[model samples]
Each structure stands twice: as C-alpha cells, then as structure tokens.
Target: MRFTWAQRLTIAAAIAVAPMSAAHAWNESGHRIVARIAWDELTRPQQVFASELLVRHPRFAEDFAARMPPDIAARAADDPERQRWVFMHAAIWPDLLKAEGKRLSERIAALPAGAEKTELERRLADVKRYDNATWHYDNKPILIDPYALPPAAPPGAKPIGVQQALPNALRELDDRNLPAERRAVALAWVLHLLGDSHQPLHAVSLFSARHLPQGDLGGNVFFVVKPRPADPTPVRLHAVWDDMLGTDPKLEAATKRQIVAAFPRSRLKQELAEPADPPAVEAMVNLWLDESYRAADTSVYDANLRAALLAPLPAGATSALPVALDRRYLPAALPVARRRAALAGYRLADCIRRAESRSRP
Candidate 1:
C-alpha cells in the first residue's frame, strides 16, 4: 500500500514522540542504510577485519546481539553475516548509550546516598566517558546573511567538531598500535559519524539577526507544526528531517537498495575509483560539509519556508512562536533528504575502504 506525504509525516511524527528518541543526525534507519551500503562495498578481508573488531565491542553480546530483531536473528546464514548485523546496529550505539545513561541517572537520583548510589554514580561516569555526544555534529555556526562571517572561537577554547572527530575515528581504526578492543570501538563510531556528517542539520547551524542571532542550535529549537486539523503539536525542524527515512529496518533495507541503484553510476564510480590519502580525505570531508552548509543556507533556511512557519514578531514581540510548515516545504525537502542519505552511504563506503587500505601490511 502506498502512503501519501501527509500519512507518512503523521506516522513519522508519531514515532518520534513515542518510545524512540530522536537522534543527532539521520535517525536509526538512515545510519543503518549507510552501514549496510558500506558493508556491501567492503572486500571480503575488509569485512572480516571489521567484523572481528566489532565482535570485541564491550557490550556486543548484551547490548547488541541480545537486541537483534527476530527476523534478522532467524535468517543469518552464518557467524560472519550475524557479525555484519551486529556492526550495523553498532551505528546506533552512541544514541542508545545516551538513553541508557539517562535511565541510570534517574535510578541513581531515586536512591538515597548509599553504596548503591555510589556504584550507580560510577556506572554513570563510565557511560559518560564514552558519550562524546557532540562528536556527532560539527554545529559550525553559519550566518544567514551573506555578508556576515562565521563567528570565531574564543582564545584558548578547543572544539572537537565532527570534521575532527570523524578523521580521528578513522585514525583510530587505522592505528594497529591501539588495542583491538579500542580500535573496534572507534570503528563503530566511524560507521556512525560518517553518516551523521552527511546530514545537513548536523553540519551547520542557521544564524539570523531577526530571529536566531545565536543560531538555531542546528534547527533543534526551530519549532514547526503540521497544518491544522492534523496534530498541531510543534516538532523541531531537525526532528522532521531526521524522521524522513522512516523507522522500519526492512523498509530501510529495501530503500537502501533502491537508492543505491538509483544513484548516478558515473558519480559513484568516480567516488570509489581510488582510495584517497589522508589529506585528500580531509579535503573531501570539508567539501561535504560545505555542500551541507549550502543546503542549510538555501533550502533548510529558505526565506519562504521560514516566513510560512513563523509569524512576524509583533511590535516589540520578543519570543518567536511555532508555526505551521509551508505546504511546499516537505515536498521540496524530501528529495534533498533522500539525496543526502544516498551520498552519505556512498561516502561511508569510500571511507571504510580507505581505512582498510591504510590498515593493511
């Protein structure tokens, strides 16, 4: 059965509000798509090496294998295929860790200060150590006004943006000197963050003098509602884009196959032609971020969409209120969202191949 845009949006928004929390970039389906694409492109040895590392993930058995879907569990051909599935789920591990951390903190708060509380606090610290949540998105502020320059960081302040984080993860994946366990963790993050960086919202934040002088926190605070008669509860603009790919794993897998097939063959061939050296890889990542920033500037922060979604502040009106998305907004943005997901998958494959090449003797 076919679903209209409105129906899809309703289902997506409902899912967003339910038990599943929104992720930093493309949601679970999007990340899984990227991982699946990369996995498909990997050579046999590369695949085996990646799986071996992933099998060593500290929580692979408890947090990954145990949570595998019944369908996937039943159909695995062998250990290698199951390992690949585990690696794909690992793409969402950081977000899951966030949720787990929150739950642990709540439990700790409910208990009195005792040995249990102390142990819980220690566990929380352990979770936080691996959290590195900010690594998912660069959040480099972009001024909406063409004439304005990006804000400079204050003296002595250090920011480990996604651009840095992703390359760092790649380095960790390539560094044989690091313990295999440590490298495995880095491999999982590399799988995830490469996908995150391709998401326009994760790469850039929109800044404007009239409404969002400090930036929209990567669209997280920009409230948007579906038209009246539909659910009017305001949702974050980022959340809307994040949910565009839907949440079903089977559907996502099918969509990944379709998107991969539909992607321009010439462009895909050019991207995968030769593994890039480190400097070239950095340049490629910067180029990708620039592309996303331009999309944020033009499409995501389009003046027409903004005007439709937000009412003018009355004379001396201080607070910006949520407004309905323009009828045309989603129709136009959906293709861009799909294109980004496809590009992310392609680039992730390129990166994994590069990492594998560098790791080989």
Candidate 2:
C-alpha cells in the first residue's frame, strides 16, 4: 500500500515512545543500537572482557541482570545473545540511573521512619553521586541564521560537556592501573556517552534573531509536533531526534542487526575518514564534535525548520507554536542520524579494542 508524504513523516515521528525527562539525544534505542554495532565488531575475547567489566559494575545485579526481560533472562548464562543484551543494557545505564534515582526518591518518600528508608536514602545519595547530568551535551552556539543575530551573553564559566567527559571516560577505560571497579563504571559511561556525542542537537544551540536569541538550548526549546498528530502539545525537537532509530523498549537481536545494518561505515566516508590511530584524546573528541556541529548546521537547522521556528511566537509564550515537521526535514535528518550513530558504534568499538586495558584472548 502506498502512503502520502505526510503519512510517512507521521510514521517517522511516531516511532518515539514517551519522551524522556532528560533532554539528551539518542534515546535508549539509539544508544543500544550503537552498542550492538560496537559489540558485533568485537572478537569473542574482546566481547568477554567488555562483558566482564559490565558484570563488575556496582549495580550490575540490581540494575542490569535483574532488569533483563524474561526472554533474555531465560537464555542460558553463556548465551551470546544474552551477553549482547547485557552490552545493550550497559549502554543505557546512565539514563536508567535517572529513572532508578527517581524511583528511589518516591520509595523513600512513601516509607516511614525505619532502617529501610535509611538504606534507601543512602542508595539515593549514591545515585546522586553517580549521575553526571552535565556530561551529555556541549552546545556550540549558532549565532547567525539568515540574518545577523545578537550575541548570546558570555557564559561566565565553561560548562562541563560531553567533549570534556568523553575523553576522561576513554582514559578511564584505558587506564588499566585503575581498579576493576572504577573501570567497570567507566565502561558503562563510555557505552552511553559516545552515542550522545554523535547527536547533532547535543552539539549545538541555535541563536536566531527572533524567538531564539538566547539559543534554542540545543533544540530543547525548539518545539515540534508530528506532522499528523496535529496534537497541540509541544515536544522538544531534541526529543524527536532522540528516537530517530526507533523506540522499541527492548532490543531484540533481530532489531539490533536491522538498525546496525541500516547505517554502515561505507555510508559515512565523506563525513568521517577511515579509522586511524586516534590523535591525542582531546583532539579525538574535538573531531567528533566537529562532525556533529556540521550535521546541526546543514541537516538540523535547514530551511524548513528555520522558517517554522523563526516565525512569530504565540501571543503570550516564549516558544513559537510547535512546528509540524514536514517530509523534507525527516528525509535529510534521519540519514544524518543513522550515519552518525553507526559511526559512533564503529568508533566506540575501535576505542575498546585499542585501549591499554584490552587483554589478549
């Protein structure tokens, strides 16, 4: 059966499930697909080493193993697919920590004065320490859209962003001198942060003459709606792209392969060079940021989206009326997202393999 362009756009947006509270991109499905792709690139021995680090994570049993869906849990302990699922789970652990922290808060709230509440409070404190909220994105301001725009106020101090944290995460994974426990934590972070680094919105904030003079806060304030939903509720453009790969809650093996195969390194030859010895850590991260910034300039802030966003705001509101994404936006945007995600996966695999900690089989 044939579908209209509008229908196709709606289909594209509908893949997103409920929006996450975090404005970061590459929602759970995206991160998991990146991890899946990286996992497939690893040899069996490498996979074993990575999986062992995940096992050593402080919350591995509580947050990972116990949370496995029944289908995965039913597999034999040595099943390769099940182990792959662990990698997928590890990739989303940071976001999962957010929800877990929220649950702990609510559970503590409901509990009366007792040892149980005290222990829960301690666990919540631990979650607070473990969560690094600022590391997901680094906004490079786009000061000029079509017309000259006023400069955004200088941020007094540099905000810690993924660009800074990612290299540290890599250093952590590669620093074999660190205890296994610390390496385990870094492994989870690297799995998640690399995928975030590739998202275009995560790399930029648009400063335009009209409604977004202060910048669009990395598209968090860039409101959009699905073409057909005609639903008036405004959704963040950042959240829309977060689910670009699709949003099934669980990552089955078949689904994983489909997403990985959709965007391979061959498709990104122009966007990225063949893997080489990574330069200094900071330089490597800057290269990733450059790819995302370029993606944001062409694909994200394209003519259609800019026109919609720059139009007048609602009479009494700060944001423009939510712009309906047309067929044109998704066509260019989805491919960029897929290509970046696939490259992230491939590059992440390279990082794991070359890390000083990688042991021979």
- Maximum-lDDT candidate: 2
Model 2 agreement with the true structure over 122-229: per-residue lDDT tens digits: 999988877878788888888655763646456797667799999999899988788888888998899999998899888888877766665667887666766664
Q: Residue pairs in steric clash, candidate 2?
A: none
> Pick by TM-score: which candidate is best?
2
- Clash count list over all predictions: 0, 0
Q: Which residue pairs clash in candidate 1?
A: none
| Model 2 lDDT-worst window of ten | 12-21
Residue 8's lDDT in candidate 1: 42
lDDT of each: 0.73, 0.78
lDDT of 1 by residue, 133-162 (tens): 677777767765554454565799565778
Off by over 4 Å in 1: 1-23, 70-80, 145-156, 227-230, 264-280, 306-320
